[model samples]
Target: MAEFKPVKLSSPGHSDDGIAVEVLPYGLTIHKLLVQTDGRIHDIVIGPENPTDHVAQKYTNSIVGRYVNRVPVGTHSFERNGVRGDITALPNESPLVSLHGGPKGFDAVPWTLLTEKDALQLFSKAEAARIRAQPESSFAVFRLESPSGDQGYPGSLIVEVLVALISPDHQQKISENTPQNEVDNRVGSLALVYRAKLREANAVTPVNLTQHWGFNLEASLNKGPETLSVKHHTLTIQADKIAELDSDSLFTGRHVPLTPAHTHQAKPIGKDFPEKGYDDYYLFKDDLQSAVPTRIPLSSFNDDSDFVQDLLRSSDNPERGLRGPPAIELASERSGLKLLFDTNQRGTMFYSNALAKSSAGARKKIHGGSGVSGSGDAYDPHTAVFLELHHPLAAFLHTNEKAGEDTLLTSEELYHNYVRVDITSKQSPA
Candidate 1:
């Protein structure tokens, strides 16, 4: 195994523009994400000090997969492409349920950092064209090859993750002129793009890759690395329905309308839910528009010269790329920071770290102090929130086929999805 090394990225031409990130190939983890806004730098991601700590503390900002969520013991078996496989892997959760790919999922393994040339092939045709047009953007790609039967999953899976950071100024094409009003709304952002495929011919497998990151928008270095609880943050989720779960928190293959308890419309995150905070899957409504409207012109990024036809095709093929409305919006009045979360996935599993407790473990720091935790620099319950983007919970269960379209993969198809976070500062005009 290659030694684990951390890679740092910053927005092009402005390394100090309050945008910096550190990523580890181990588990494809995002170790640090510091964004400057409101004249302060905020380390918004919850992570451990040592990159190796991710192996034991897997929930930190790392990629989770094979199957992203839960898989009941008996429902672990699947049949696809006329082949059958049973995932008898040891269960990590109670009641013999497999959680996050049965312990040694993608988060527990090391991935290979692909060279620029090699990674170029992994980017979608539209993304490749976009990257070519914006060479100044900062991005890194990591690859992982999972052999058949690893974690009891069927096929050999080749997965690639592209993490990219774009500054507010470059959110749109460089050739376009920005209006003053639009410039104020422009935000610095980070996007994670995933691509996966079966390596063996006719092989079949269940794959649900998702990025798990606990965000603490209250993180800040304005007054010497001061960190606050996420309870103070207000949150909104654009969904009309939520998953119905059993007592053990496993999906019950039923959907229910969002109740006041789970429905968030700019509500205080800490006070809106039950004592532990929300830990449920919110399904996107059919009328939901594509997440976070962007001026990047995704439809025209194709290489084809038939612009009109390409646009029409892109409209018809919503699944081809990132689509869906800003699934979540979180903001902190104190920090004057707002997080616009969007993804192409069907739903998001929202967790408020209800069970998380202060740890003695080391954490990443800036300006000689730590961020993303409550006072005393310890992560307490409700200090951070995780918005896991992917298919519905337990999508691998054959009974929930309709809930998960692309979770079951065959050699003929490729897996693709993305999660984009736009961090904008809502500062009052001086």
Candidate 2:
């Protein structure tokens, strides 16, 4: 792992106007993540570092580039008014088009950490992008400059990453019993915000953007069980449609029924997840809304003790070997998480770790306070399911009655795309 610089995370009312996040001088970005009951850090993001390198390779906690996620067989061609661009860097090799901005993806480039003492952040510009890779004939991406036509993409884009440490008060609360703790109405700032913005490069109209990051709520270094829960979690998705996964749980052409339309509705992630994890896009039903309220069933267990074991176990039926399907026991455990969304962007992809399974000689371990343990896919199936987001109502945004709609990306569209996660364990600002 590359040596990461750290950022000092503090409470609210802590900084000046232009500063979205107060950073340190190291190359690393410090994110202030709040911990709850038992004082454990269940809130997972990248950069904190993982025991294995597979995660780093998977772009864990890193800001990745130009176009995120799978773009349909790597061929997203467009003819703006008559100009053609067959973005061939996509779809991973064997492509008629481009994928992820070609091999020199944004993740591969090393970003400079803007720092000032114990506060530092990761920031990248459009000008820096033009230095490394070549562009396409019709479209190009010029870092810090107007968009180039060499990469078959449009307009120049700039992206930044910041992390902060927050909420040090929860140290005692998390250590105490039951998570039904009281909230302090003090004026202390206890959260971190990752602010992202996008404006057209050379005034090139609009663009579609999103963040693709995989998450597993019950992750601990000593604990890596496939145990997960969606039941009683009361998931309030903002969308109307569901994108089903193929046999492998990757995005297929099928759209499944999106359950839990209005209120609280959710099943164990594994209950419906196939042998592999779930990897599909879900359509949002609510637009211009804030907060996707989801409650963890951890404290609402039928039998809290029994539920804990199930949540910690890698598999219930080990005899079936590695291919056995493991349903989640959301009957127990509490993530103490109240995910609140704060973005004009739309869509969220809820994926499950379908590609996870035990390694050659891995063992399942457990912790006293942390609960369960399993080295990702060590004992149970531990794959990653990413929640990806994109432009609000992207599919039908430009469609018209007489003429077909065009989906042309914004130059600044390449700037920032994401689903900002807020650990709202306390009744704080989301």
Candidate 3:
């Protein structure tokens, strides 16, 4: 196998308020992410310190698709003009599953640097469009044109992804003169917005895209102990059901009630961490929205505990035209870092890095050294967690006939999906 070397690119004046980011043309990967905390800077996402290490590492801070996640291994069928055709999984990485857009997906390819003005823009030759970004909000957009039969899938597709980092300052502002009963809501937070669009003038295809940034809120790749992991982080997913998966980790088209062990109601991740470490999809409840209202009066709560409880509760009726609360929240009390994840998609895939240790071991043989240097033991199990927003895998399955109209995207209609990540300093009760 030939070595894949990634080209590094930088955007001028992108840093703000002690937050810094670095992007790569390969996969438009987020190479370095640093946030200032306690007067010191720390790297939050696990990524290759050196550009060459990217090829051997997991999709570390990179965008993966044609399709995100797994599509069952075999010949799957789709419909076109009342005719049936089959698209088979490449089976490049796994023998039984087609993971992350086959063996040579977007993450493995190098993109062209189109423009570096307000935001960085990258173009993939295979996929006609460009991926753009801006420094102020740390926003990046991916625009592409996928020709029919590009990746074993049927029909042509035009995909666009908009990713932005929304700071707490942009959220609903709280007033100093507000009543004492109201929550004093001042927390440093950032939201990552992933908006995707599919436009095709003549054909329809399966579309599922997600941002795969594995987060370790407490530890930093540039600082802290080598063995530091995300095992201590607390998790809560606003989901009551889960999609069932077979041994190979493909969705079995079944939605089962969440088990007690899988319950994430402000609970420690390690408390009931699954043996496989969360490679499952949590189907969020329908009544929630993405953002917390700027302020809520104390009349609704009786005490501090009630305040926390109320804050965690999903809005019964979100405002007439507003995004809802996060589908999941991951926090690290040790480092005072908290992450709120909100998405308009139907489900969120939570993956604990349980296989990292083994994967890293295998990567060492192909790559001269470990995937990343200066980070000791950073590839351990449960070192980080990935929350991906998208339709359930079942939506893409085609057994004997085409999927229902709701699951597939058409040329006449536009498909838009949004995912928001709110990074905040956990506030303490008064």
Pick by lDDT: 1 or 2, better one: 1
Question: Best by TM-score, which number?
Answer: 1
On the 0 to 100 scale, the lDDT of residue 145 in model 2 is 21
TM-score of each: 0.81, 0.54, 0.73
Sorted by TM-score (best first), the order is 1, 3, 2
Taken over the whole model, the C-alpha lDDT of each candidate is 0.67, 0.33, 0.56
Candidate 3 Cα outliers beyond 4 Å, as residue runs: 1-18, 79-85, 113-137, 170-201, 221-227, 289-322, 358-376, 398-407, 426-430
lDDT of 3: 0.56
Candidate 2: misplaced stretches above 4 Å? 1-38, 46-56, 72-76, 79-86, 91-101, 115-152, 161-209, 221-234, 244-266, 286-332, 357-385, 392-419, 426-430
Q: Highest lDDT among the candidates is held by which one?
A: 1
Q: List, residue by residue over 68-159, the lDDT tens digit for candidate 3.
A: 78887778766544434456777865788888878877777765433344232111221112122224344444455566776676666655
C-alpha RMSD for every candidate: 6.4, 15.2, 10.4
